[model samples]
Target: MQKKVPQIVFDSKKPENSGIEILTIESLASRKTEIIDHNPEKAHQVAFHMIVFYTQGESKQLVDFVWHPVKKNTIIHLSKGQINAFQFTKKLKGYILLFTETYLKNQINNSPKNEYLRLFNTHLFSPSIQVPQDSNIIRYFDLFYEEYNNHTEDLNQQNTYKSIYSIIFSKLEGLKQFQPFHLKQSKQVNIFLDFKALLELHFKASRNADFYAEKLNITYKHLNTVCKATVSITAKQFIDQFIVLEAKRLLINSDIKSTELAYSLGFEESTNFVKYFKKHTGFTPNNFKKNYL
Candidate 1:
């Protein structure tokens, strides 16, 4: 049987908070005893979005089995359903903000122009952002901390919370241009996101880009163009990466065997899946498991 990656809920909370919780990383690490049947040092998936801004020191954070080296002013965003783990002993100084999707929907500006608010879409942009000393990102974060922790509830303060979060995300999104990949046009990004949604729903049924393109009601060439423009990869390459990513996620988090996972992921024969996995990733499923585990 395949055991699942432990799925943590948005239950970690404080009495004063409603849908959001903000605390220092040091304080978060000290509550290891509060978690039952799970270790914070090991990989597990979360049901809520997370933001960790490193104000000082250095540490490595694990997301989807990949370890990211982080330093001062580095902020990482982890979305719902992504796997992550922390290095509690690394003397990192930061604040972690955890919020549910409902809270985010209320806070986010859904106006079509605000792509930077798409902070958790690791596919379009990198999950981590480096803040400059002169930037107000940290200042706004501090303001939010003070406001949220004030233990006061009123329509006015609630509106202030929304406004502060909006500024923080927009500022962070504006900083994404500093990353290696520049932002794509909104139309291109929207197309890729649509295709991604369909892929996630039907990836087990088909790995071919044509299947998704047809479902998206666009030409295969158009889909390829959209993917290349948005993520710098062909549509087919994107699908393959998604599959391999899912495979790696399962291999490390669950006790499922290689053949079992292959079938579960929709390979006609287990042997073909083995070859496909090795072709894209250097390691066979078992070898990848051994190293990560």
Candidate 2:
């Protein structure tokens, strides 16, 4: 039987009034435990953006079946539709801020959309960052939480939250700037971004680099150049990496059969899927599943 991944929505206190919810680590853990206990196979695919600030204690979380360690001063940002499971200790202390894409889209200006994309949308980078506990990042989160709780229908109050949100992204941008191989805007960067967006849309049905290049209205050579310059990988490699990652996620988190998953992933034969998975990951799909389990 193919087990289904559960879709989780933000359980806001006033669902009709706001699309945001703020809860502490303890609260989130309790609620998450209850849900998982009721349905052990419920692998959550959240439909909203989540920003988690870990202020104390150590914990682990499975994001898309990858285990990430959480510690004091660790901040993890998860975009919509990513699967996550909480595995934190009782001593964990922090905040989990949840907000819908619609709310963020309506609030954030167009100027910072690229930065937003780099931070939130890009799967090439790790979604979590470790920073100083007393840094301005935590301060901005504190301000956002305070403003979120005090939210009103007043335009000024709403703008206040938007302003704080912008500041938070600014802080994230600053942190990213200091990291090695940070994203920079350029013609190649723009092309690569567009290619990534298109790949996400068409990867299942079409994995050809030329197909993506045509969609981007550029030559395959140009697309490859852009991808190599932006991320030090060929365009074909990028596509394969994305597909293999998705395959791993499914293999570990669901009970989808190999033949069915192969067809679903556009492979004409299960043997071809096995060969492709092994070529990229050095392990066949079944081996990878066994290792993961």
Candidate 3:
């Protein structure tokens, strides 16, 4: 195994790709090795956001360690820092939309309040969205695909790319509301998002719910309330779940030892870390790695 999951970066300097890479799944298969140094069929972390819209055929995409079955009109979202693996087949057909973080931020800068948060909240929603065949999203994708293919200009030099991105995003935002357990725009959602931001930044420093609650300037009970409201779990459980998810990612993506992994995750004692891992996931770190990896 590698030291860590391979990080695939966007090549904006390529005029053909620019800040955005729009290509068919067939085209992606040909360029897979150029984008990822490791096996594209294996789980790898992406540095940019990716969306794959299947126009035909069927396949399963592993997103953040979950295998989601996808078919025609299915939109698979792979957010930044998320681990995704592809199961390629000659019969599958799709458009893989990839964009740089800078481009994404620029487009979302003008979005209404909490719109940006709702766009990529993979922590709350599943990574896949099924678009009904009759939906206008198909029309939007067709237009974008048609325009993108005929234009040889750098997308960074054109405003059409940005506008199309926002359009597709807004359309997907509407479809996302239909997903089970999808959170609506609310104060609790905002609180949960803020708490999640802090948790990501300081997860290694401390997994204590109170630490994040204090950082977010919200009481522990309030933080717990928001977490339960948003994710059906208490704040502490959410922190544990986050740690376990990270631990699982590291366990599968790397060959780091149990003791080393424990300290790296802020655990002072390896034994305690082992116990904690088993308590939350029902498997010790080594057992999880052995069973899953």
Which candidate number would show the highest TM-score if scored against the true structure? 3
Q: Could you tell me the lDDT of residue 94 within candidate 1? A: 83
lDDT tens digits, residue span 1-293, model 3? 34556777776544445478677776777777786377777778888999889888888999987899988889998888888888887788888888888777877677763666776888788888888767888777777777776655553545676678778888988888777767788888888888888888998899889999888888999888888888898998889989988888877767789899899888999999999999988998888777764
Per-model TM against the reference: 0.86, 0.82, 0.88
Clashing pairs in 2: none
lDDT of 1 by residue, 202-241 (tens): 9899999999999989999999999988889999999999
Candidate maximizing lDDT:
1
Model 2 lDDT per residue over 102-140, tens place? 877875554467767777864555777887545778877
Q: Model 2 misses residue 279 by how many Å? A: 3.2
When 2 and 3 are scored with TM-score, the better candidate is: 3
The TM-score, computed over Cα atoms with residue i paired to residue i, of candidate 3 is 0.88
Q: Model 1: clashing residue pairs?
A: none
Which residue ranges in model 3 land beyond 4 Å of their true spot? 1-4, 16-18, 30-36, 151-157, 290-293
